[model samples]
Target: MPSLKDLRKRINSVKKTRQITSAMRMVAAAKLRRSQSDIIAARPYAIKTNEVLVSLVTRTNPDMHPLLRVREPKRGVVVVIASDRGLCGSFNQNLFRKAETFIKQNRDRYEDIQMVLIGKRAGDYFKRKNVAKRAVYTIGTPSYELASEICDDLIKGYVNAEYDELTIIFNEFRSALTQVMHVDRVLPVEPMEAEDDMMNVEYLYEPSEDILLEALLPLSLKVFMYRALLESAASEHGARMTAMESASKNAGEVIGKLEIKYNRARQSAITTELMEVVGGAEALKG
Candidate 1:
């Protein structure tokens, strides 16, 4: 049993912590809203681009574009997205778990396996291990510039035959309280095995199909990388907001329990003093 003073101090400390967590929850909510909107806005573009790519790939040969060539993976790489900062519950933990599982499950497929980590948490985790080949911790926010640069490097690696396959792993934003983890193959793009009548749908090209593919295929990959980053950003914010809210609620519960304990302890002290006074008076009277 804690003393009344100790209980009171605990209560106050918990209240202060509750305040901080509540504030963090609000900030995370704001950031989440902004990120969510951005991802939502990007969805239409992603859909249309996919439609175009599907049609184009059906009409053109896979050899027409460097990104479309599929090969057996000899050296495989995973691009993992986590967060710069924590307090987001198991967001990063779950992501890292998925990444680790991927590596373990696919270990037999590749002679060489490596990780390309984005954000501080991912870098920190992999740095202690022998698996990380490269890391960039400066991904403070999701941006087109960052996405473009990442895609460029990945494409360069693929073109140089540095890696036969690449995969990107990240969290996909579903709702404020929910997120889905995704493992997407970054290269070489999976060619359409079956072209439907949808692919039969054609249009006039300003330039030759080869020229269009040369430009569009890379653009398609960049867009994909950008979309994944956006999804990850939104998911991170949502997870943080949820975690903060839960922390605040837990703090409230602790404060409530502490207040009850404080009241009980104070009452016990007062009762003890009253008994002592009564006994002293009785003794004096006797």
Candidate 2:
């Protein structure tokens, strides 16, 4: 039980909290809308580019391109995309857990396993882990230049035999309330099964197939990376918006309960004071 003054203070504190949460929810919603639009626009181009790139890779000699060359699974690296900030409920945690499980399960498969973490949260979460970090990046906004830089680094590492395989782990934005975890094998480009009609149909290239592939493969990879970043950003915003909305609602409920308590306490105090005044007056008259 608290006095009227204490109750009033608590109600004020909760009201302030509710205001903050409400503001955060709105801000997240605005960001989410922008992120959603970006991802939606990028998806079609990314998918089609990947399809064309895969078709070309399968028909050509894998040894012709270093990126297409698959090597022994001795060493591997996982690129994890997460948010820099907290308050996105379970967004970072889920990714961290998935990455942990992946590393643990494949520990016996790969002789060496390292991490390429994007976002501050990932750096913080994996800092104490036994795994080694190849690179850490802050995820500010998804940009083509950033994607190209990261793709080039990974390509360089793979060509230099620093790592045998590359996998990217990220959250795919599905809806405001739902996100799908995606684990994509980004390097050592696997050949997709070609359709029967397409395999038989030979098309002429103005440039040599090798030249076309040389340009397309890296671009495809960069597009994929960019799309992943967008998806992650959108998912983070969605998660935060959902989380903040829930917090605001919970705060409102708590305020309601506290107000009831405050009212009861104030009423009790008033009733006691009134009773004392009446009793004193009656005694004076007597």
Top model number, lDDT: 2
| Model 2: pairs clashing at backbone N, Cα or C within 3 Å | none
Local distance difference test, per candidate? 0.86, 0.89
User: Native-vs-model 2 lDDT?
Assistant: 0.89
Candidate 1 positional error at 153, Å: 0.6
Q: Please, what is the TM-score per model? A: 0.93, 0.93
Residue lDDT tens for model 2, 219-250: 98899899889999999999999999999999
Candidate 1 error regions (>4 Å):
193-204
Quote the lDDT for 133 in model 1.
73
Instruction: Show the colliding residue pairs in model 1.
Output: none
Kindly give the stretch of ten consecutive residues in candidate 1 with the minimal lDDT sum: 193-202
Q: Distance (Å) between predicted and true CA of 92, model 2? A: 0.6
